[model samples]
Each structure stands twice: as C-alpha cells, then as structure tokens.
Target chain A: MAEPLFDRIALIGIGLIGSSLARVIRRERLARRIAIATRSPETLERARALGLGDAYSLDAAEAVQDADLVIVSVPVGASGSVAEQIAGTLKPGAILTDAGSTKGSVIRAMAPFVPEGVHFIPGHPIAGTEHSGPDAGFAELFEQRWCILTPLPDTDPQALARLTNFWERCGSKVDIMDAEHHDMVLAIVSHLPHIIAYNIVGTADDLETVTKSEVIKYSASGFRDFTRLAASDPTMWRDVCLHNREAILEMLARFSEDLSALRRAIRWGDGEALFALFARTRDIRRSIIEAGQEVDAPDFGRHVVAHHPQTPQPEEG
Target chain B: MAEPLFDRIALIGIGLIGSSLARVIRRERLARRIAIATRSPETLERARALGLGDAYSLDAAEAVQDADLVIVSVPVGASGSVAEQIAGTLKPGAILTDAGSTKGSVIRAMAPFVPEGVHFIPGHPIAGTEHSGPDAGFAELFEQRWCILTPLPDTDPQALARLTNFWERCGSKVDIMDAEHHDMVLAIVSHLPHIIAYNIVGTADDLETVTKSEVIKYSASGFRDFTRLAASDPTMWRDVCLHNREAILEMLARFSEDLSALRRAIRWGDGEALFALFARTRDIRRSIIEAGQEVDAPDFGRHVVAHHPQTPQPEEG
Candidate 1:
C-alpha cells in the first residue's frame, strides 16, 4: 500500500466539511493520524463518538501539534479567529488550507496570521448537502466535486502539488485560481442563488393572501427547489453573505434588473421575451449535466429518489 | 370489476400534464377511452406513437364528440381558443376542466366560450416533473400529489363531485377553492418561484465576471436547482407569465422587497437578521416533507438518485 500523503492532518472545526474530510482522509488513507478540534465540546465529543479522528481536542492549538496538514473548516466570519488561535502551533513547512465558501475574505482573514515556514493554500470545495454537523457528513461528499485551490503568489509549488494530489485522492477534481476570481465566480454560482432562495422563501412565508399551509402543500409545484438551498446552515450562509458582500450585492442587483425586465414582459404580454429567456436557460442545465456537475435526472431525479416511492396502495374496489 | 368513471374522455393538448392524465386515468380505470387532441401534427403523432390514447384527433372539436369528460391541457394563453374549438361538440352532461397553472385567467378566458349545458370547472393539478411533452409523462406522476379544483360560482355540484372523484382515482388528493384565491395561492407557490428561477439562471448566464462554463461547472454549489424550473417548457411558462400577470407581479414585488431587506442585512453585516431569516425557512422545508409534498432526502436525494453514482474506482499504486 502507498504511504499516507500526510503523517498527521489537524482538522479545526468538525462540522460538515471537517467531519467529511476526516472520514474521506481515513477512507482514502490520505492521512496516518487525524486530529479533530472544534470550539463546542459537544461537537468535539460527537466527533469522538463517531470515531472520526485518532485524536480530539476542544482547543485547535492542541490539535495542530506536529500535524503535517492543517485544515480550518469554520464559518468564514470565524476564519481569522481560528487562524489566530492555531498560527503558533501549525507545524513548520506544513501545508495550511481551509474549506471556506468565500475565497477573498478568507484569504484576507487568515493571511496575516500565517507563520514564515507555513504554506497556506486557501481552497473552496464546491460540494455539500443541505446538512451540517459531524453526523451529517460521509466519505463520499467530495466525490466528483470540484475543489478549488486559491494559492497565493508566494506559495511553495511542492506544497500546492501535494495538496492537489491529496484532494484528488479524496475524489475531488482540483482547480487552481486566484482568490478574487474565485470569490467572484462563487458569488454568482453560489452566494446569489442561496440569497435569492432564502429571500423568496421568506416572501412566500410572509404572504397574507397565500396561507402557509397552501404553500407547504403545493411546494412541489416549483417552490420546493428553493427550500433545499434555504434550509442550509444559517450561520454558514450568514457568514458567506457578510464575507462576500460586494460580489453578492452585484449579482443581486443584476438579478433584480433582469427580473424587472421579466416583469415588464409579463405586464406587456410580451410572450417573445418570456420565451427567449426561458428557452435560453435550458442549455445551461444541459451543460451542467454534461460537465458532471449536476444530476442528469429530470427534476433533480426527485421522482426516482428511492425513499419517496409513493406508489398508491392497492385499493380494494 | 367497477365500471370506468367516464365512458369516453377527451384530452386536448398532449403535453406533460395531458399525457400523464391519460396514463393515470387509464391505469386507475377512470376512463374507458381517451381521445387525445393537439394543435401540432408532430405532438399528436408522438402521443399516438406513445399509445397515449384510444383515439387521436387533429381537431379538438372532433375529439370531444360524445365524451363524458373533456380536459383541456394547454398553455394558459391558449385556453379560450381551445374552449371555443371544443365548445360546439362538448356533450351537454360532460364535465369540462383544464390543467392550467393559473386559475383566474384560465377561468376568464375559458368560461365565456364554454357552452351552456357543459359543466365548466377550472382546475390546476399541483403535480408535474420539469420535463414536458408526451414522452416525459408517466402513469404515477399524480400519485401523492395535490389536484386543486377551482370551481366557478355556478358550477354544478354533481359535476364537481364527479370530476373530483376522477382526479382522486387518478391518485391525487383533491382540494376545492375559488378561482381568485387559487390564483393568489398559485402565484406565490408556483408562478413566483418559476419567475425567480428563470431570472437567476438568466443573471448567472449573463455574467461578465464569471464565464458560462464556470457557472455550469460549479452549479451544483447552488445555481443548478433554478435551472430545473427554468428548463420547463418555454411556451407553457410564457403563457403562465402572461396570464397570471397581476398575482405574479404582486409576488415578485413582495419578493424583491424582502430581498432588499436581506441585501441590507448582508451589506451591514447584520448576522442576526441574516441568521434569523435563514433559520426560519427550514421549518417550511420540514413541513413540506412532512406533508409529503417533498422527498425528505437531503439535496433532493441527488446522492441516492440511481444514475449519479460516480464512486471512485480503485486505483493501482
């Protein structure tokens, strides 16, 4: 068997990303020892109970001791504090990274704390379910997903290569780009979508003319798709909203402008404009499917998802 | 064996809803014969090739001859024309209904053309996959879904009851509401969601900062869900936007207002407000899942959807 890529991997904040990393690192034999740390004692104990790592500590500094790779997986808002806590402990010449959703903000938050010998390569893995916490994770969460590494200009090539190789071994296709571009790309693809979903769900919830019961009962009509994104972890999304503010605001403004045009077309009975917009969006879904970034099944394959098999009970006439 | 509810059923428009109704009506023995009609020769032939009906007709008027039930399943903008085409031939005692998404507009357009003795009931079945056309349907599409009937003030009770039974037998739980209220409910639950989805996908596509391929490659991060609704039949959505203009506009305005508040929260770093909004929306998803309107699987069960098992193959060292 090939030797593990890292002798020790210190995981700060064992939430969904951290726990999943722990599981995958163990499954792929990417690390010989996993050190899990989280602020909440309850969460740390839960990770211990799940047998997620070889060692567990409530203090992140203790977890990073002698670790070859240190991954900080906290909300983007907390990145600086987490970085501050463990900067003195991260092993010299060790690779430092993160699984944050925002790149530029996280880079800004953590860069100043990095010690001389540490190689900090910020990454954002484009993967997750609408779930959080240690138990909500599995080894397969990163499979066929993209893990984007935003390496600073001065980062060591050997460290970046080793980190990319590790992510590949753990089932992610690795992409490299600068933090600013990564932030902008994610703001459109992720941050804007989530904010729009959250906002729409709030709108639906607040309507006086439309009862909540009716909305809930008929959500499968179209509204349920947004609910999946809306049900995402509140703290994490709030952090993304704050940390990626400018890009998100820019995307939202563009979306609102486009929506105004759509509203105008509807008001004027401009069927051509409506059809043009609706017709063009289909190609993107097809491309996403072909790119292996989405499920090819129609309606996200909701009909075929096994647990919801609602075949009518045989009725005795 | 029980006798079929309708001796003959006429289906106008052989798209997703119409063809699914044909399959389910046959499977549940609700109709002894289904006479399918559509405007396009290609769609009519496709319905015929799919064996979707016992009889096929290019003319809806010809198809409705002596039928006990006539279901017009077309884009909302085309409802009145269909009603006019079939009105002269509709059997006096037959229950005439539609499967349009908007109730009020469909009622206004269709009611004036409905002949005196034929029972005219406007209904919007809260069931469908994003796929459209005859081939995209199945016998079980209506199972465990809601079928909302919007009966006009003068609609006969016996006709309403009979039509309700038909939808029920076809495996939908039926609800009755007035056209105005139904329109408002659907405007929030269905129309606004589709419009917002279309708008967001359009926004993501029109981005200068993010390339189209980048959006497609990272769509699973969030944007892909909107594409499902946006991928829906363009003609159908175009008509829906045109027909449900007022209620849809109201919902869109409300949504935009709420979005403004959310954007403020993001801009000012009001984490509590952002978290509060995000936290409250989860209950709705849970309720929808409990109401059986949504599958409880995380990520719409993308992980469990059969075709998407991109498990990493074992690698030789």
Candidate 2:
C-alpha cells in the first residue's frame, strides 16, 4: 500500500476492537511492527495463535516499549489500569489513544498517566458486533464506520493528524469533537440503547404471564432485534454504564418520560397520539438509512431461512 | 403442489402482510383463485399492476363473495370494519381468519360480525419487514417463521386445521393458543419492543445537546438497530397499541419498572449489578438463535457494503 505510518504500533488488550485493529493494520501494512499484549494469559495465547501481531507479550508495558504508537482497546472500566501499566513505557512523541465507548471518563482516567512528551488522544470507533474476543474481529469492521476522536487541549496537532490518517486507512472517517460532547452524544446513541436492550430482555425473561419459552419461540415478532444488542459483551457494557453514568442517566430519564407519555396515549386509546409518534420515528430511520448509517434492506437483509444448532427442536406445549 | 387448500381465497386490505400472502398463495398454489381487496384506491391499483391476485376489487364485500377462505390482513384497528364489510358476503362453510398482531382484540372486534357457519379464527404469522405497502411484499417472508392461531372455543376444528395447513405450506410452523395468551405474549415480544424503540428514537430526536447529524452519523454503535423496528408501519403499530392497550400497558409497566432498577444501578456505579443483568440477557439471544428465531451472525448479517440513496456524500465539516 503506502509506507508504514508508524515504526511500531502496540495494541493493549487484544479483544474484539484490538484484534480488529490488528487485522486492519496487517492488511493495510500500517506499521512496520505490531506488538500485542493482554493481561489474560489465555487471551494473549489466543491472539498469538491468531497471529494478530509481530510480537506478543503479557506485559502492556513491555509491549509498548519503543513503540511509536500505543492503542488501548479494553473495557471502559479498565482504561485507568491499562494506562498505568503502559504509561512508563511509551516512547517520547508517541501517540497513545484508546478505543473506549465513553470519552470523558476515558480521558479523565488515562490523561494523568501519559508521559510529558507523549500525545494522548481519546477515541471511540462507533463500530462493533455483539460478538467479542480475538476471533470475532475482522479487517472490515471499521469500514464506513465513524471514529470519533476527542483530543485533549495541548495535544499535538501532528499526532492527531497521524492517528486520524491511521484510522482513515482502516476504513473509518474520523471526527474531532470535545470529549464532553462526545460522551453526551454517545450516551444517547450507544449507552442508552444497550441499557434499554438489556433491561427489556431482562423484563421479558422475568415475565410471569408470558412464559420464557413463548418469548423465545415468538421472538421474530420484534423481540429478536433487541436481543442482538442485549447479547453484546456484558463486561464492556457494564463498564460503559458505570463510566458514563451521568449522561446515561440523563438520557434514560428523558427516555422514561417519553415512554410514560407513550404509555398514557395507549392507555387513553389515543390512537392519533400513538400514530403521530410512530410516524415521527419513521422519518429518523429513513434519515439514518439515507445517511449511510443503516442498511435500507428490511430486517437487515437476513436470509429467508437459516438453520442453527439452537433452533427449536420441538413444538411448544 | 398438492390440491389447493381453498377453492377461492379472499385477502382484504392489500398492504405488506396482505400482499405477501397474495404472493405466497400464488407461488404455493394455496388458493385456486386469489381475490385481493384494499380500501386505498392507489394500493389497489399497485396490487393490480403487480398482478398480486387473480381478481382485484376495491370493495371488501365484493372480493370475499363466494370465497371459501377469507383472510383479513388489515391493521389490528381495521379488523372490525373489514369484518363488518365482509361478514354478509362470506360463503357458506367458509373459514375466516386474520393476520393481526393482537389476537384477543382482533377476535373481540370481529367475532360479532362473522356470520354463522363461517369459522372465525384469528391468526398472526410472526413475520414481516419494517417496509410497508403492497410493493414491499415478498413470497418468502413467512418462510421458517411462526404462525400463531388463537381460535375461539366454538371455532371449527376442520377450519383451524385447514388454516394451519395453509400457513405450513407457506413455510411457517403453526402454534395454537388461547387468544388471551397470544395477546399477552405478543404484547411483550412484539408490542413492547416497537414501543420502546419508538420512545428511544423520539428521545434521541428531542435531545438538545446532541445534534441530529451526530446521532445519525454514530448510529452504528447501537441506535440504528432500534430504528428498524421504529420504522415499521405507523398505522399498523398504532392499531396494535390501541387494540392491545391493556396487555401492552401491563408490559410497559413491567418494562418501566425494570428500567428504573437498571437506571438506579447505573446511577450507583454498580458495575457488578449491571454486568449480571447484561450477562443474563445474552443467554436469551443465544436461545433465540438456537430456536431458529434469529440469525447468529453479527449485525443481523447486514451486507458489509450497501448503497442507500440517502447516504451522506461529503465528510463532516
């Protein structure tokens, strides 16, 4: 492709996002050398087995030694610890960025540990699947996705450009925004959806009148859509909820108020009110589809039929 | 295929569900002659242009005249009017059923109008796309999905068996349940998800801090998934909420209560509580996939690349 952008790139925490970065780096030849490290020995071995990097280690500090760029891809809750582990090893002038869902919290967690000469930028790639771990990653995960960078004040402009270029090469369009604004936006778009999905699934599970088996059997009705988000990695989502608490709570409060009003409309047989809201929501989906954020295909273009091992084997009694 | 299930079949209300039934009926030879009717003159013309029926009419009564099987596929709220329109024209020994989301309400609305000797059964095939109107119809929409029939005690066994056979031939597995049970199950699995999706999208739209473009750009994170369900036909969903108000309200209360607890957990920074709930929900998705109710692939198996007419053409400023 092009000449390597960085002499060495170290990835801390080899999970879905980390491994996906590794794949894209290798595919695009974005770095002359790639070093990967994870605290979990099993994950480290798995990443090694997957050949996700040129060098692998259990120590985040060891992995970042002499690396020109260090990217952290870990649960939002673990950002501070990862920053502490690798802070001393970053080469001078090296760029350290993170792929976490919450920007404000992540920036607060890691900024203090960044060495004086190092450039620390907080970034979140608005892309992922419900699946996790090294094997779940692919080079194409970031294609056409938005990667939002929330650079701190005094951050080097050259380092920001280089990181943006790196992400652009991996098939992402980068947007620079204030870290606080990023958290608030993500609170509505990301955190709240996951929390709502998880809550609804839990509610369905706990229903006494509607059996769990019936929920599973008839899920194609609408419930299955929520399940995809609910099925996302628990650790990552938990961290998101904990880290982005204030913005998420504000969004959730607004959501509850709106839902309550909706509930009232249904209670009062206000078909017009329900219709108006439903009609209004329809335009948003159209806009999202038009904006290339969503597929226009109905049902995300799922095949008409697919057989899976978990498919119901017998009729419900 | 085998002998036609009905000598004449009338489908009243030629929207997405109705039109889809028309296609599948033609493809599978489910009816010797298919008669389609819609209240909307525009839709009637579109269905005729698409050749979706052997006979087309704007009058529901005229369409059902002499038909051995009458299927009312309008919105749940329209079931009563359609029943009133076609009740007097139903042939002797005809089987009348409907594909509506709320079985209890549909049955309650239509039961009084169904003429004696016309076996009245309520049916809901748990299949569809967010798209609506006659042009969105496809022959395979019902393939491998569930079709639940909530037949009254006085419902004819032979007529129920015939309807079951009809759905089976269209590639759905049939489940017979009480109308109330069907209403409650669907209230949780179908009605609530759409309501929640609509509410969340509305919330996002009303946000003062997050620009609409920012929400649209970053939707891939989690928000886009909900938009699909929220994009579903407003008239249909409105009818669902109006007709299934009690069951839906009950589910909504439960959902709100559960969501409140989740909000508290997040507010308290209880990562363990959030993690436990998050982890529990993943199993349901796995079970749903196992039950053949959902796709196991990530992002609902969306194409890696898809072109939309509304896709953004320029990078953000």
Candidate 3:
C-alpha cells in the first residue's frame, strides 16, 4: 500500500465519529500511529480496551503533542475548549479539523484558539447512525457519505488538499464550501429533521387521549422512523440545536408555514392539493435513491421477524 | 394447513395492501379460492398477470358473488362505492371487512350498505413499504405487524373470530377496538407522522437558498428518513387525511404547539431544556424496538453502496 499519510494522528473525543475515524484510519493505514483522547478517563479506558489507537490519553493536550494531524470530534459546544487544550500542543505543520455538525458555530468557537501555522479546517461529514459511544462505530461508517470541508480563506493549499485526501481515504467523497453555506445547508438537512423528530416523539409521549402503550404498539406505521433519528446522541443534537439556532429557526418557520397550508388543504377537503404535495415528494425520494444516498429496500429492509406480546386480544363493548 | 378459513375470498382493489393480502392468502392457504377486483381494468390485468388470485375482474359486484369473505382494500374515499357495488351480491353468512388505514371513516362509509346478516369489520394492518400497486407487494408484508380490527356494536362474534384468525395466520397480532378510538390512536401513531414527513420533504423541495441537488446529495444526514414516509402512495394518504380529519387536525394542533415550544427553547439556547427534550425521545425508540415495532439495525441496515456524482469539487471566493 501507499505510505501512511501522517506520522501521528490525534483524535480528540472518542465518541461515535471519533472512534469510527480511528478504525478507518487503522484499517486503511492512513496514519503511522493513532493517539486517542477524551475528557473522561472511563471513556479513555474503553477506547484503550478496544485497542482503537496506538496510544490513549485522558488529557486532550497530551494526545496532540507532536501529532502531524489532529481531529476534534466532540459536540460542537465543546469545540472551543478542545481547541484551547490542544492549541499549545499542536505541531507547526499539523493539519487540524473537526467533525462537527454545524460549521459556522464551530469555526467561531475554535478559530481564535487555533495557534498560528496550525491549519484549522472546519468539516461536517453527512454521515452517522443513531447510536453513540466508541463501540457504536465501524470502519465502514464513512462509506458513500459526503464529508464537507469549509476551509478558511488564508489556509495553506497543501494542508487543505491533505485533509481532503485523508477524508477520501476514509471512504467519503469531499465537498469544499464556505463555513456559512455549510451551516445553512446542514440546518435544513440535519438539524431541522432531528428537531422535528424529537418534537413529534415528545408529542406522542404527552398525548392524553391515546395511551403510550398504543403508540409503542403501533409505531411501525411511520412514527418508528422518526424515533431512530431522535434516538441519536442527545449532547450532540443539543449542541447542534444551540449552535445552529438562526438557520434552524428559519427552517422551522418555513416548515410550520408549509404545514399550515397542508392543514388548510386537509380541513377544506382539497384532495387535489394534498395529492399534489404528496406526489411531489415521491420524486425526491426517487432522486435520493438514484443519487445513492438511500437504499431502495422495501420497508427499509426491516424483515426482522418480530417477537411480540401474545395477542388475539378481544375487547367487548 | 388443516383447512382454509374461507371457501372463496374476494379482494376489492388490487393495490399495495390488497395485493399483499392476496399473496398471503395464497401462501398460507387462508382461502380456498381468491377472486380479485379493481375499478381500473389495467390494475386488474396487472394483478392477473402477477397470478395473485384464482380469478380476477373489474366488476366489484361480480367478484363478491358467493364469496365467503369480501375485503374492500380501496382508499377510504372509495369505500362507500365498493360497499354499494358489492351489497347486492354478498353472501348472507360471509364476513365483510376492509384494510383501510382509518377505521372510523371506513366504518361510516361501508356500514349502512352491509347486507342484513353479514358481519362488517373495519381493520388496518399497520405495515407497508413506500411503494404502491400490485408489483410492490409481497406475502410477508404484514408479518410481525399489528392488525387492528374494529367491529361494530352488533357484529357477529364468530365472524370477528374468523377474521381475527385469518390475520393471525397471515402473521400479525390482532387487537380489537371501537372505530372511533382506533382513529384517535392512529392519528397520533400513523397519520401525524406521515403528514409531518410529507410536509418536511415538501419544505426541503421548495427551498430557495438550498439547491435541490444539494439536499439530495447530503440527505443521509437525517432528511432521508422522512423521505420514505413522504414517498408513500399519494391517493391512500390523501384519503386518510380527508377521512380522519378531526383526529388528524387535533393531532396536528398538538404537534404544532409542541414544536413551537421546542422552537422557543432552541431560540433562547436553553441547553438543559434542549437536552431534556432530546433525551426524552431516545427512550421512545428503545421502547419501540423492545416492542418489536422497529428493527434495531444501525442506519436501518443501509449498508448499500452508493454510486455518486464525481466529486472533489471546490468552491473558492
């Protein structure tokens, strides 16, 4: 195989994204050594136990010392502190990046702490499962997903190219754009969907007329799909919501506005309008499937035989 | 395997749900003979070509002649007309049921036309994929899903028991409830989730700032989950919104109210509130998985490799 891209790579925050990166880096031989760090000694120990890296450290600063590349994969809200911890320890030519969901907020929080000559590129990979922690990751997590890099204007060309090449090696195609644009795109694509999911699940939980058992029993129709997104890491989603507030609010405004019109159509019994709206969305799913972002598996390939509560339950009125 | 449940079962409407019932009936030998009917000759021909039934016709009345069980699986809006057509030909001791999504409306539309001695039960098999038409169905579509039956006050117990047995044989747990309560429960569990999904996909489709291609390219982040529900058959969902309007409207009102509160919490950067809301939803997903309502597969088992637009595209100011 080709020579390793970096002498040593430091991964700060050994969560889902961080651990996945470490696995892929090791599998693809992208780095000579992997140094993993997280704030909690318990989590650090777990990473060490998993043999996820060449070395493990609880101190973020200590992990980055002498590393040729540093990737911060914490929640967006914690990016600034992580940058501060590692800024003094970063090697002069090391490429620094983050796997945050929001670009603008991450840049605002981390840029000031990024020491001179250490390249700081902000990136958000459009990939993940609803699971978190070190064990929830896999080497194939980045396959067929987009990794977006929002490099600052003054960043060195070679550093950007190297960072792009690293993500490409990790099994993602790279797209380069401005930080502000990346945030706007993600606000609608990622943040709003998670918020809507959480809101709907909350609504179902708070229902007075329908029992919670009923919702749980009948969720396969559609509600269960939302629950997967809502089941995502709480800290990561909360940070995304707080960090990407304005864009999310704007999307929410548009969403509610559209929902009101749909409600009116339903109230007025306008089948034509409802049909048109529903029909328009079918092509989008088709397009997504064709674009390979989604599988066309019927029922999302959920053919797992369900084991359920014994039933043939009859209710006499 | 011992003996079929019915001498001859007539299926009205050969779409997704109807066709699936035919396949399952044939597979499990739930009926000695299956007769299929559709309003459109084209669809009926498609069903015949698929060899889904023992006989097929475009006449709803003719299909039900001498049938031991007749199932109307049309959209809720067409339930009344199917009931009208088959009323004159129904066998006195036969069970009459529908696989509609909305129980209350189906009961209202078909109850008045039921022959004096025939049992009229409304039910919904809480299972489906995004695809529609005869070709989109399989015998296992209802496997491990809930099939809810709402029998009228004076309905015969033997017929209800037979219908319950039929669905159970077809691989579903059976629940019995009144039509009104069924509608209320489904409004939160099924209807609202589909409406929300359609609304969000519509919102993403109409964005001025975000390119449609960009949305499709980056959809795996979270938006693609909604697209599956949004891509559901338009005619079926439109009828559902119209037929179950009251319960749906009430649910929509609740959803909007909860969303507004979530918006407020996000706007003010209430990390604690945001975390609480996000954390609260994770358990619902876990509960659904435990209830056998969802597959606990990571990324919904979406390990399909994606073919994509050639990229390494960079945008510079």
Candidate 4:
C-alpha cells in the first residue's frame, strides 16, 4: 500500500491485544517482519501456530533486538517485568509502546527501563470484548475505536507521530492525554464497570435465596449483560485492579456514594427521582450510537452484506 | 392454520412486548382479528402505521369488545386503569392476560376488574431489547424465550391450556409460576439489573471530573454493556421499581451486602477472593450458551441467515 511503517515490529506478550495488532499489521502491511514473544513458551507456540509473526521467541530481549517498534501487551501488573526483560536489547531508535489498560501504572512500570533513544509511550486501546487470548482477537477489533496515548514530558514528537500514524493505519483514532487524567477517566468508564460487573455477578452467584438455575434461566433481562463482563479474563482484570488502585478506589467511592443515594430513593419509593435519573441516562446510549460505537441490530444485518462478498445485498429500505 | 386460537385478540398498550406479541400472533395466524389499543393516540397511530394489528383504537373498552382474548401490555402503574377500562367490555369467556414486568402488583391491580366467567391470567414474556415502541418489535422476538404465566387460584384449566398453546405457537416455552415467586425471581434477574444499570449510568453522568465525551468515547470497555440496559424505557422501569417494591428491596439488600463484601476484598487486596468470584461466574455464561439462551457474536452472523430466504446456507463445521 505504502512503505511499511516499521522495518521490524516486536510484539511482547501475544494475548488478545497483541494478536489483534499482529493481524491488523499483517493485513495492512504495516510492518515488514514481526517478532512475537511472551513469558510463557506455550503462548509463544500458540502465536506461531496462529501465524501471527515472522519470528517467535520465549526471550523478550531476543524479540526486541533490531525491532523498530516494540509493543508490550501483557497485563498492567506485568509491565515492569516485561520492560525489565527487554530493556537492554531494545533498539536505539525503536518506539516502545504498551497496550495495558491502566496508563499511569504502565508508565510508572516501564519508563524506568526505557532506553534513552527509544520513545516509551504508554497507550491503551479503548476497545475490547470480554473474551481474551489470541484466538479471541480479530483484524477488525480496532476499527473505528479510540486509542489514548499518554506520552511522557520528554517524549520525542517525531516518535509520537510515527506511533500515532501506525495506530491510524490499524484503524484507530488517537487521542493524547496525561497519564493521570487517562487513568481517572478510564477508571469511571472501563475499570469501574468491570469491577461492578464482577461484583454483581458474584453477588448473584452467592445468593442462597435465588437458586443458580433461576439466575441462569431468566438472565436475558439484564443480569446476562453483567455476565459478559464478569466472564472477562480474571487474571487481566485482577491485575488492572491491583495496578490501578488509586484511580479505581476513587471511582468505586464515587459509585458507592451514588448507589447509596439511589438505594435511599428506592427505599423511599421516590418515583420522580428514579424517573429523572433513568430518563437522563437514555441520552448516553443515544450518544454512543451516534458516535458509531455500536451497531443497531437491524442495521447490523444490512451492514453484514457489505462485509461478506459472497452475500447478495438486501432490498433497499 | 390451526383453527385460530382466538376469534379476536385485543392488545391493550402497544409497546415493545405488546407489539411483539401482535407481530408473532399475526405471523402464526393465532388470531382471526387483532385489535390494538394504547392510552396515547400517537402510539395507536404508530401501531396502525406498522400494520401491527387489524384494528387500532385509543379506547381500551372499544378494543376489548367482542375479543375472545385480551392482552394488556402496559407499564405496571397503568395496569389498574387499563383493567378498570376494559373490565366492562371483556367478552364473557375471554382469556385476559398482561405482559407487565411485575407480577404481584399486576395481579392485585387486575384481579378486581375480572368479570364473572372471564378467565384472568397474568403473563409475561421474558424477552425484550433495550428498545421500545411498536417499531422495535419483530415476529421472532418471542422465539425460544420463556413466557411465564401466573394464573389466579381459580383460573380455568381449559383457558390456561389454550393460552399455553397460543404462546407455544408463537415459539416460546411456557412456565406457570405463583405470582409472588415470579416477582421474587424477576426481582433478582430483571429489576436488579435495570436498577444497577440505571444507577451506574447516573453515577457516571454525575461525575464532576470525567467529561461526558470521555465516557462516550471510551465506553467500549464494559460501560457500553450497561448502557444498553440503562437505555431501556424509563417509565416502564420506574413503574417496575415502584410496583415490585418488597421483592426488589429484598434483592437489593442481598446485592448490597454481597457488594460490600466484594468491596472489603478489594480493599484488602484479596486476589484469591476476587479471582474465585470472577471465575465462578464464568460457568453461568457457559450454561446460558449451552441452553441456547444467547447467540454468541460470531454465531449471530450465521443465525441471522434464518431471516434471509434467498441466501444459500454456509456449510456447517
């Protein structure tokens, strides 16, 4: 299409996000050669089997050698260890980035070990499904999604532009923000939702009065929605919580306070208060749809034809 | 098709559930003539525009006249008034039912209006999307979903059988449950989830620091799932909260207690407790998939094919 963005790209930790980037990079010819590595040999093997990279290695240091770009896609808690593993071998002019959910912790974890010439930018893709691992990713995962970059004060402008261009090529819109602000924003939008989901599902599971079978059978109402989030990778989310403690705790405090007020309203049978709150939240969903974050089911049916070359188009509406 | 189940079917309150039943009943030829009635004339006109029924009216009394079956699908708060309006016009042997979310209050509100010899059976189709209104319905909305019937103590067996057969024709599995039990079960499954969703969205909206644009932009993580449930009809959900007071309050108490325990675990950084709870909930999702309750996203692409008759089938793996 155009000259490849990077001569060689090294992906350290080939999980859902890494594999997805690998697929997108390969599809768009964004990198000439790709090196995949994870701490676990089995995962490295799985990446090889998936044909995700030109080279696969269990040594993160070996993987980043001579790479023009290195993306660390491990859990937030493991960012420091991954950085430690690859620190000495990182190429002089390489762009070092990460796909950790928490920006502040990732920056704190990796910034210490980043080579002087490397652009160690902290980034988080504001998109993911509940599913995890290599098989759960697809090339379209990043399409029309946001990717936030938290560049350090001394970060080179040219390195930032190159990395932003790479993400753009992978079908993501990029936004730059301070790591602390990104952490605070994501705590409310992403981290807190996952925490609340896990909490609610756990609550339902532990209920002695409401049998498990009943919960599972009648879940189509709303509980099922929480289940999808709760079913997310326990290790990844647990690491997110552990790593982003301050932001998450702050969001949780706010959420609990607000929930208490709601509980009080419900307890007092305040219909007007409940109605007002419920009415206001409807706009958020409208905003999400307007922002092109989700597909309306009927419209999705129509759009599917555009994706599938074999399928004939539906009659005009 | 099978000697029309009812001579005439009157649907009072044309919203998502009501309009869906109308569509399915028409598709399956379960009723000879359909009479649609809603309190708002605009909704009645919209139902007519959608060809949702053979006749449309604003008068509940007029709609129920000579109808062999009457299905009231209004918010729980409106159940009493709808029952009062249609009580005088129900045919002598009409099987009267409702599709309200709350069961105990609906039965309490509707039971007083039952004319002698009219079989009053309160029912609910445990299926819906976040969308409302007549346009949000489809014939297959009820397919493979559970339709719970909470018949009164002195309800006629013959009427129950006929209604069960009617729902079966519309492609739903039917269950008969006591009104109180149904309320409690639904309090955990439906009401709590909606209330939680509404609360979380409200919490996010009220955040002094996080901007609305930030919430919308980064919503794909987990918050977007809650938005779908939060976007549900405010009036309907408000009525559900007010009407199903006792069961909902009880469930809320349990949910809050469990949530507090989770908060404690998180505060203490108990990874084992968090991981254990998160891991356990994964089984429920598996059960739901196994029970054919939800279509996984990948499978949804294939399942949508059932609607397109012109498309050739993809080979099964």
Worst 10 residues of 4 chain A by lDDT: A298-307
Candidate 3 Cα outliers beyond 4 Å, as residue runs: A304-317, B304-317
Kindly list the per-residue Cα lDDT of model 4 for residues B1-317, writing each as its tens digit. Answer: 37888889999988888888898888789999999999887898899888899998989999999999999998999999999998888899899999899999998898998899999999988887888888877677776778899998899999999999999998888999999989988998899989989888998998878999989988877787788889898999989999998988888888778877777777788888877777777888888766666645532332223234455532210
Query: Any runs in candidate 1 off by more than 4 Å, and if so which?
Result: A304-317, B304-317
- The parts of candidate 2 lying over 4 Å away from their true place are A303-317, B307-317
Task: Give the per-residue lDDT digits (tens) of candidate 3, residues A39-65.
Answer: 898899989988999989888899999
**Residue A135, candidate 4: alpha-carbon lDDT:** 81
- What's the CA error at residue B26 for candidate 3, in Å? 1.0
Q: Kindly report the fnat of each predicted structure, to 2 decimals.
A: 0.80, 0.86, 0.83, 0.58
Native-referenced TM-scores of chain A, all candidate models: 0.96, 0.95, 0.95, 0.93
Q: Write the per-residue lDDT of candidate 2 for residues B63-126, one digit (tens) a residue.
A: 9998988989888888888899888889989989889988888888899998888898889999
Candidate 4 CAPRI grade? acceptable
Per-model lDDT: 0.87, 0.88, 0.89, 0.84
Q: List model 2 lDDT by residue over A82-143, tens digit each.
A: 99988887899899999999998898889889889999988999999899999988887888
**Candidate 1 local Cα displacement, residue A243, angstroms:** 0.8
Order of candidates by DockQ, top first? Answer: 1, 2, 3, 4
- Report how far residue B3 has shifted in candidate 4, in Å: 1.3
Highest lDDT model number? 3
